[model samples]
Target: MKTLYVQVDINSYNGKLYDFKTDIADLQKGDVVVVDTINGMLIGKVVGYTDDTKATKWVIDKVDTTAHKARLERDKQLAALRKKLEARRKAVDELTAFRHLASMDSEAAALLTQYEALIQ
Candidate 1:
């Protein structure tokens, strides 16, 4: 019998490739599977099959549809939060630049400083 070695790529890990042994014959590309790594159990996508015979880890199980949906939602939320923060940072920089244009002792400069501190 030929041992199946599946190449897995974890989303968070990006381009890294991890190989694990499995008996599940129905697994296909893009299928999410739980892998047994030295650190612990991790979820990864099956990118392809590997021909290497030496294997020390096993693919525990495929991730269910419910879990996959939850992960996708979590990723979406994280991306939205990152975009919001980026916009806020750009606004803050513009505000700071606008404030710096005023004279050092002017009342407008003082007010702007107070407003900037409040926003920050």
Candidate 2:
């Protein structure tokens, strides 16, 4: 199958930003891309693809299936970690509410805050 691979740089807070290469064929929308992020590789579903001819020059690399699978596994692990973090946040919220309703125990509040901060 003839596939198009485009290079993209994703910032921590900002999202996927394309660094278009002049030599490569302009990528189309719905193209699958393997983005190399800070933590690891990620398979990003293309939301936007452009044919702007004035982009900067760069090299495009071919992505194999093995690399793609590894990216998928990494994504799964990241998702699980996010879920755990969210659960911890919810627990902290519950504890804070409980503290407000019942006791004004400073120790329990401090402990929950410490735990919540640690997860992040």
Each model's C-alpha lDDT? 0.86, 0.57
Q: Model 1 off-target regions past 4 Å?
A: 66-120
Residue 38 C-alpha lDDT in model 1? 89
Worst 10 residues of 2 by lDDT: 55-64
lDDT of 1 by residue, 60-80 (tens): 998778876999999999999
* Residue 73 lDDT in candidate 1: 100
Candidate 2 C-alpha lDDT tens digits along 1-120: 333334454444267566444233545554555554444655543445455545543333324458878999999999999999999999888867866844577787777667668867
- Candidate 2 stretches with Cα past 4 Å from truth are 1-63, 103-120
Error of 1 at 16 (Å): 0.8
Best by TM-score: 1
How many backbone clashes does every candidate have? 0, 0
RMSD of each: 9.5, 13.7
**Candidate 1: pairs in clash:** none
